[model samples]
Target: MASKQQTVASFVETAPPGELSNVVADIKALAPSEAQALAPAYKKYNEEQYITVKLPDGNGTAILSPYNSLDNNRYFDTATETSFEVDHASQKTSNPQPHALETPHADLLRNLHKALTTTSSEHFPTSSHTITPTNTDPSTLTILLVATKFSPQNFWNARWRSTYTYNPSTTTLAGSVKVDVHYYEDGNVRMNTRKEFASREVSGGAEAVGREIAKLENKFQEDLNRGFGVLGEGCFKSLRRQLPVTRQRMEWEKFQGYRLGQDIGGGRAK
Candidate 1:
């Protein structure tokens, strides 16, 4: 069995673009030999997540989660379980039906912008005054709006519920554990930060607003894990030290209506 530390080191060493291809080639080279026993496990692990360097020559890198087999069932299965049906009579019914398509967060932000700008009875005149989306450039403004929606404050306020229904036996190691442990140990925090920055820039800065939410979420997860491990030892004490600065950045972004300079202590967000 591979040591967790060794697995993490291997991932980190191969995570970079110029190096990752070489690493994959090495893995391929190993398939007929030492790593043959683990080939099935490796194939499944590769399917879960992979790194993509957008501009391999430049600094651009992205962690891609392309079309996993696991994600499709989540959306489709719910409708089947509910037994909801739509017929011609119901389609022609004169009552207003809520939008059937499940909207993505990005789409919701766009709708929020449209609602803020367009005049209607549902939207208050004062609300329009509070948010001026017209004068601002749509590309830049949309990003800013999205960022505000997902700010750390808003994310924490939203109701959150999650449960892990399946747990592997403690006695034996499993393939799933290998994949998860690989990610947790080998994933690049800096790459994640860059991806967050680029995504915000692409989405009209909404991607940037996600960083704060990400920070809070990371802290929350850390605290939860620590709470489970040792009594009275909150994991966020060192992490919280940086919150004041992030709060300042959030405020600056809110008021100035632009992204702050990306010098968050050498881009570590700590």
Candidate 2:
């Protein structure tokens, strides 16, 4: 009769006959030749330990690790290897896929957070500006409606920005909070908001972050509607002011592309 295989956890708890060495040997076998060079230890997850391995030929790099949820002798890591292909964008380039799902609004949100928390308001006082808060804390997030402007003379441009701290309950929130409200004027203006968390440990992790952002987006929409209405009125005022009048040809002035005054027939003006 054949002897039954022992599990890693069981082997750890009880020193079985030559089984410890066998487990190490098993890891060595399953791990790649590159991992062998580094001498990988038996890991709990995926039956393989984390190892950093590189190609002998060139500057190519990769980190490969096997992961498993539970300890089972049947499901040990087998033949762990790193591919030559790597995305420089991914710090964990050895992993098959990117770690964090970076949404499209990442850049915009990052800039907003940066400007609101650290910089002072007086830096750029015109066209675009950042509003400085008198009281700032790691916890206690607050948003102030600083200033939003639509150009009275030229309504083609419009913008708004504000500062806020993202956390209220210090006990519940870990990591410093940063929040910024940003408005950019394109041809058509519709407000959109997004949020992302950094690697630092948070109180509730992603779940907490999701809840906070949902609240922020809703708040953003409410204010956005109000701002839109006011800015729209400004745009209409400017447009009406700039509307062409019927009786206004007294002198030789720039009008259309042609010389359309009393003496000047329809011809290109110099």
Please tell me which predicted candidate would have the highest TM-score against the true structure: 2
lDDT of each: 0.27, 0.32
Error of 1 at 249 (Å): 52
**What TM-score fits each model?**
0.22, 0.24
lDDT string for model 2 (38-96, tens) is 21123331122112333333344222222211122111111122233322112122223
lDDT of 1 by residue, 146-241 (tens): 110112222121112111111111211111101111112333322211111212111223232233333433565565566546643456344443
Please give the lDDT score at residue 63 for candidate 1.
Answer: 19
How many residue pairs in model 2 have overlapping backbones? Answer: 4
After superposition, the stretches of candidate 1 with alpha carbons farther than 4 Å from their true spots are: 1-44, 52-54, 67-212, 231-270
Model 1 lDDT-worst window of ten: 172-181
Q: Which 10 residues in a row give candidate 2 its minimum summed lDDT?
A: 68-77
